[model samples]
Target chain A: MMEFINFYLIPGLVLGSIYALGAIGITLTFSILRFANFAHGETMLLGVYITYSLVQFSGVHPLIALPFGALLTVIVVLGIDRAFYKPFRNSPTIMVVIASFGMMLMVRSMVQFIWGVQLKGMTQGIQRPMIFFDSLRISPKHITIIGAAIVLMLAVHYLLSRTKIGKAMRAMSDSPELAKLTGIDTEKVVRMTWIVGGALATAAGVFLAIDTHIDTNMGFKMLLPMFAAAILGGIGRPFGAVAGGLVIGIVEEISSYPWIGVEPLLNPGYKAGVAFAIMIGMLLWRPSGLFKGKVF
Target chain B: MSNSELQTVLELDQIIGGYGDTQILHGVSMRVDPGEIVVIIGPNGAGKSTAMKAVFGLLNLSGGKVRLNGEDITNMPPDQVVHHGVCYVPQTSNIFPSLTVEENLEMGAFVRTDDFRPRLQELYDIFPPLAEKRRQAAGTLSGGQRQMVAMAKAMMLEPQILLLDEPTAGLSPKYRGEIFAIVKTVNATGTPILMVEQNAKQALKIANRGYVLVDGKNKFEGSGHDLLEDAEVAEMFLGGGAPP
Candidate 1:
């Protein structure tokens, strides 16, 4: 039981936090901009590589390079929005979707062109784990991932509930025409959405790279889990994505353990399958998602 | 004839426009003054709502200009209309359905930089039902309550002139009466209004003046009682009933 708690539960929580960070971006983009934003995973990949380069240039720790990387990612994604997505905003929905898929490929190839295809570890050494209560061990990297996710989520919550721009974003999401009638500056709100979504995606990438490995394929690999979590929780719900991410992460980890009589039927390799299963279950039971979010 | 040109709060002078090249409102002109309720009644496709939209700058106008007070505000975007002390309450999608009643009110004052508390208090006092359910989502409210919320939100801006498109649309008779009573009380606060209403007979009762529009043209313009009593106006539009 002790081994199970330490190995599966703690690790699951870390993985869940990473997934939550990514899904928040997805949900916000879907809500404010009204698109699936398939390039979100690639955006995270760009963030991780930027953090890697920042760490190398400044010789700073991954944790220290995080904010800079996130800020740069925000700038990059905002530029991307202005260049590519803004022009086609009023176009057909499927056109924007196809554009995003193309953008996903575009971003992936850019990372490959610059950083090459080799996998890279964020930190130099095999860092020691921090010991908690009896037989409970966790790494500093995992602790950072969990802490960062919590802090970012709290900041986002405060922004959404207590700020004017946040209120405008929600209002626009509810009804764009009504929002315009109410005198909300829709363009400013759109730019703010990109900033928030970009920063969250960056944090997700940086933490993910630190915990596992940094590579061009990192974001692509996370695509299924992040999207599944977003869909399962609620397409346009930020907090719901957090809940969905934790569920997917824990399920994926626990399914790999020998819980049912000795040997486990599901392997850790079936982590992707766990996300698919949960997403399908949510779709079957409540298509609006757990929080009654936007169905599309 | 009701309010002179200088006293008029809003004037739509020979307004002509529609979606794309199809003109819905042709040479439709109307005006409302300070502290007056001017109601527009017409058939389903008679451009009553289009006139309101053109005045509120929801779409482009092919001809004619809208004057607020005395300033020409022709074809200004909807966002800028509220700044000129004019606000619009859409017939539908009036309130942010998912937002709480309080949030809807807050959004109503979105463009204002000054304090909104004074007007908010006044609105709550006027609509005590809204005040009691301030935390409830506007979507969850009954049809009458939702109309009240919509009216209350537009009132939050404290506009000198309020433009309403079918405020009592699709409401029960009891709710309709309640909305008219509220509208009467709202007009008492020095705000003039131009509204399109479906219940022609009931709406004209409280209206200071009324316009009968047919095919986007003004068929009859008279004092509320005169139009209510005019045989031709009644036979053609008001369903041949006594003004109740």
Candidate 2:
């Protein structure tokens, strides 16, 4: 039990926090923009690389360098949106979706060109876990990641519930035509979507980097699970995305736990299949997801 | 009264427009004077709603002008038109279904920079039922209640004029009567209303003046009582009977 708690559960939660953060952006973009943004994973990768460079240059913690990375990422995303997405605003949703897929490849290539395809570590060395009650081991970085994620989630909640622009964002997601009739500026709302989505993606990338080494393919690798999290939570439901992310992350880790004897129940090698299975099951049984989000 | 006070608040002059080369409004013209309830009643595809859309700049006009307070606002987008003190509640999908009723109203005042709490309270007073369901999602409400939410949302901006497209489209007669009464109460508050209504008789009963549009042209324009009394209008459009 101690080993399961320490090695599987704790790691699952840290990974879940990162997935939750990334899934927020995916869900927001999917719901508000009316397209599944394929470039979202690359957006996360771009932020990670930017934060990696900042940490290398300034010798600051990734968290400390995160805001700068987020700001830069937002700028780049806004530029990309204007160039690629804006023209397809009135076109069929598939057009923007294909554009994003193309953008994914383009951004990945750009990252490879600039940063090179090599793994880079955000921190120098892994620190030992702080043992509690002689058996419970919780790493300091895990605490920081979970704590920061909670703070950010709370902030997102406040923004969506309390602020004017945030309410407008919800309004747009609910009904774009009504939002326009109500005098909500569509472009402004889109810009705010990118800002919030970009910042959260940056935070997600930074958190993941702190947990594991940063690689060019890191974001792409996590993309499927994050998407599974978003769909499981509900397409446009942010809080649902958080729950979905935690569930997916925990399930992926626990699927390999030696629940039956000690042979590793499902073999850790097949962990990614768990997300795929959940996603397929969800699409088949509850396409609207757990929160009754928009279908399709 | 001063000349400016008598000036038309909203006017559509020879407005000609439609969707994708289909000209729905062929030289449609109308106006709403201050504090008046102007009803535009016509059969299906008669350009009643299209005229309203043209006024709100939801569609482009090939010829003619939309004037708010005598300022030409032709082809202005819907968002910009709201800033010009015109709020339009579309016929369907008018409320943010997933948002709470209060949030819907808050989004209604999205363009307003000043404090809108007092205005919100004022709207709540007018629409008492909405106040009760302020926290409930608008979509979960009954058809009548959702219509109320839609109208109340448009009222949040305290606009110079309110444009309602079929406010009582799918409500029961009881709710329809309630909505008509609510329209009168809103007009009593001095905001001119220009609405397109399917319930022509009831609408004209509440309207100060009304227009009878046929095939995108104004067939008859008179005081609501006069139009109701007109034998030709009664036979063709008002279900043919003695004036009730």
Model 2 TM-score is 0.97
Highest-scoring model, DockQ: 2
Alpha carbon lDDT at A273, candidate 2: 94
Per-residue CA lDDT of model 1 for B173-239, tens digit only, reads: 9999999999999999888889899898888999999998889888889889898898887877889
Report the number of the highest-lDDT candidate: 2
What stretches of model 1 exceed 4 Å from their correct place? none
lDDT of 2 by residue, A1-296 (tens): 89999999989998888889999999999999999988889999999999889988999888999999999999999999999999999999999999999999999999999999988898988799999999999999999999999999999999999999999999999888878878899899999999999999989988998988899888788889999999999999999899989999999999989899878899899988998899999999999989988887
- What is the C-alpha local distance difference test score of candidate 1? 0.88
Sum up the clashes in candidate 1: 0
| CAPRI class of candidate 2 | high
Model 1: TM-score for chain B = 0.97
TM-score of each: 0.96, 0.97
lDDT of 1 by residue, A1-96 (tens): 877887888888988998998998888888888888889999999999998999999999888898999899989998999999999988987888
The whole-model lDDT of each prediction reads 0.88, 0.91
Clash list (residue pairs), candidate 1: none
